[model samples]
Target: MTNAHDHRADLTASFEPMRHFMILQSESDVRVLIRRLLLSCLLIALIAQLVQSQDSEINEIQVGDYVRFELRGNTYQGPVIQATTNGRLLIVDVSVDDRKSRRQVKREACVRLTPAEMNSVFKPVPPASKSEPIELTMPTLAEPGEGEEIALTNEQLPSVDVSSPTVLDWSGFQAGKRRINKVPFDADPDLPYVLDISTGTVVYSVASDHSTDIFVSTDRPSDYRLVRIKNHTVRIADTLPQHGVALGLIRDETDHDKGLCVITGLSTGQPRVASAWSLPKQKVRPLYCHYRRLLPDGSVVCVYENTLRVFDGRDGRLCWHCPVPAFFEPAVSQGGRWLAIAANGRLFVVEASTGRCAGSIPNLGKETMQPCFSPDGKMLAVYGENRMVITRINDGRVVLDHQANVDLAPFGGESLWTAPAVLVTPGGYLMDLRKNMLVWKYQLPADVNEWMGAPESGWIPIINDDWLSFVRIPHQDVTQLSAAVDQNALVAIQAGDSLRIEVEIKDDVRGDVDAFKANLTKALESSGYRQDISAEALLKAEVVRAAERTDHYINFGTGKTESITYRPFGARVTVVHRGEELWSANQAGNLNYHIAGGLQRAAKQLEQPPANLFQTMQLPRRFLSKKFQNGLGKSSVSIDGVK
Candidate 1:
């Protein structure tokens, strides 16, 4: 029995060791499983943190946040007034020409403005020194004896208004007047003369039986040129007064010394001799003389009889030439990239570099038409007596075809295209093409004789019997009014508020009114607003017109007949609460080309309500006449009442 017990003990001891080893192995496996679970939890937490950070960054834009954005290649900075529920659009309150205006921009295009940038943008700029009238001696012109060289000198003229305060400002437009004293009071009417505002230079002619004298004067007295051709008649080219160069013809009864001469360096404070070139006698017809133009790059474009010719400025060498029919005065693009001319009752756009036909627009009336290219060179605008057509150059697309109710022709001058608006001269009408409406019209003062504008400088020169003055089109003062409305709207409405929508259409209009109403309801719901017919806030939408018209014309670029059906739509919307209108918006059919397209765009606009809904709604009123002041200061509303 003792021996059996000892063997059993030894066996038990060995089994105990093995059991301990198995227990340790099981513990180690459990530890490994726990470690893997801990690692997985840590990885999941890190990934979640990264996703939250990205989401916050993407949704950082909010109302009242100052931002900078790009539109149409122009940079604009403003405060975010509204954001669309879908995060696609943002309404910004931007100051244009000192006027507070609401502009809608894509959210992706906006960047948060740095603190420094915001401060700088809001900083007040010192006002410019007021202009004081100063008199200077005008250049004296004396006819020289036959074959005698005559030199004329004049006192320094008043500095050009280029140094004057700009008509535009971040806060708004500042209207002031500056007098140009260089124009002689006793200037001969018969002699041709021109004032080039870009260079502050003037060229005039003095003719006598013995000699014809052409005098070129700049702001500096030392920079003056006098050209004398004995027994010859000098006629200053009326159309070639630009780029600090003066072009004219020196003609005699017998065709001796009959040629075109250009004077350069008139604006560089250095006057030099004339660069003379002879043209074929037959080519120097009246049409050629009237159609000549000096391009911005010193090249000269002229219609010589039946051909369009570009002459180099350095030596009057022919750079390029193309055959053309009878044409109106050609307009060179701001950068001299394209040349626009109306010929054979159509508009032709030619490449300034190679003289290749870039594009053309047909069916322009046979009546006189003036063509003007936009600053970007991507669009062309042709103005007629009753119609204005704007076309896109890349594709033969007619963007706008506006028929006016009155005579649309300029009173006595031509139309001028600036960055913000097109100034139709003589009539003093400032048309904002983006809105397709006339923003301002100046009533002529009794003393003012004519109106001419400097497109590059934004100066409108008014010629009176006494002197010339430069002034900007006066803009209405709506900054304070807009601010008041914006502030009121920002405080009046809250998220998740219940509202009602009502739509009304005119008898003449054709549209899906029900669809529009449904879209409005959806947009409001997406913005955290509940739609209730009995809600205090009532949104009213009225469609005044919706019609389509087919237009057929010849495409000058493809030389093919094309037809375009334009759908015109107009709508007016207002937000009313407690029997008072809190906000209003209107879309004129003339501004938008398509009915259905316009309605969809408008719905999208509504999806992103502006922070200052009142000011935004008043945007369409800018097109009204200045005397029309119906809703200027009616934004006082109670948020409690809206609820």
Candidate 2:
């Protein structure tokens, strides 16, 4: 494989669309980079040898003098007279691309002397032993093959469902934001979806279509595997913006108490660890690596086995670290200010900045499900065996309580003995700290229990056995929705009733599908079209419009756009001028909707035909007439035998 030295010796271009160069590398792009580096190193060594042979040894061997030498059966020659201080042979060449000849690129050759050459012309260089192994440090974001850097005892950890020993088929399941898969062996407990920011690849493994091992199942073997669809159609993993940054956990071989450090992904192409400036030097300190959370604040909260470390939002830096409870699962507030830890069926609300317990909820029976923080960061919901409890995060007071649904079945009947997968859907329950009473519950998906059980923050429970139709609750795209794509557009479509408009929008955001929908809707509105709107005051409104078939009649009347009826592949928008059918074009019956570029194209074609510049309008008999025989003003209005 080519090394970094070879590539650095001759890297005149950027690494965009790097896949095309993969053939040059032995394995992946990294190997190609290595090969390049090695080649450059060899050239430098060769140049140095030549320079020494010329120094104080001969005239005419001056700077700018070119020499050719045969060493170990390989010929080495390039124009280079000046010897670099570091013992490199320098040459210059220009790039050439033509029908006849090609040349010219500034080239440097570093020469190392062979034993024969040294004996005959200069001092002999010593040879090193071949048996000694050379250690190579390849930079990466996540720890490869190593166990978790942060260690915690079982007692200080949250009950995590890492799946089980049985290899289950989870292919085709849409991994919500983050999917956690446990290892069957104790070696590596967790394997989550990893995003490679540099390449824009959502690196993950599916149970190999034929494998029974979880590790084997979730492997990424393809270079351009589909990550997620943009606006429900176009695959977007390979796009520049949607690519994930790589991360790796590396232990500080020098210090042990500091624990482990996390490295972020890079696009350098040459394998290298993240630069220290990429993250904060302080937060980057070592700690028992437990679990890492992508917080709403854009910073990651990495819970150590014993300590809690907070880093900067952009770079991984030490924001703060505090000694805290062990064996606890950490939950962050939506506002990112407070963290809740569950231990011994009790809840401890800790200030995220200081890791000090601000409040505690005690006397919980049986093991407690992790506590949930409300969007406003005031209330927290804790699920117990028989009753689900809600408490104020600021104070240790019970705000609301309800008997847990005892009839709830276990997830896939995997382990009925574990705690019930209970979760409080957003907008589901109302809890007020001042008044301790359950107020209201929103209508959740009726079959939510059938899906992936209960919910956690930023992740929704999804269960769909059917391949064709799937339902997602807490409709994802609303967060980035705007007025341009919101309900205002719905009113415009009704008001204008214009004909023939089409557009293609592009989105390259790295996030959930909902975010894409919101952006697309906005783009549509920005292009002067109204979006369907039915709700008010939502971050993004879920716009649902019936997709009309090729031949269809749309009735937007009675102050509403009522319905659309499909015709037999012949319906077209006709313009009436001077009591004649000026022009009409048939809609393509193909299921795939082809959005034409603009109204100007259609308008230009329609305006040049049939030549009736003014006067009356001809309406379709079916639109204005009661029947075929009973028609309107124009004689051509009759449908039967009209052709």
lDDT tens digits, residue span 387-417, model 2:
4456654445665544322211121111111
Which residue pairs collide in model 1, if any?
Answer: 81-611, 97-172, 97-173, 98-171, 98-172
TM-score for each candidate, following the candidate numbering: 0.41, 0.29
Candidate 1: tens digits of C-alpha lDDT, residues 1-643: 1123222232122112111000001124778769755754574365345435434212233434433222221233222233322212333333232132122222123444443443343321111122221111111122211221111121122111111122212122222222223223344312223344433445555556634555554444344444444554555553233334565555556434345555543332223323445444243443334345555445666555655567654345566765554434455666455666555445666665556554465634322544666655566677655456777655547766544333455533345565634544334455556545444445544222222223443444343333333344333333333333333332333456677889877855655667777767766665566779989877788776445555455546667765555555567676665675554545543322222433345433432223222222211111122222122322211111110
lDDT score for candidate 1 against the true structure: 0.44
Please report, in order, the local distance difference test score of every candidate based on alpha carbons: 0.44, 0.30
| TM-score for candidate 2, residues paired by index | 0.29
What shift in Å separates residue 475 of candidate 2 from its native position after superposition?
8.4
Candidate 1 similarity to native, TM-score: 0.41
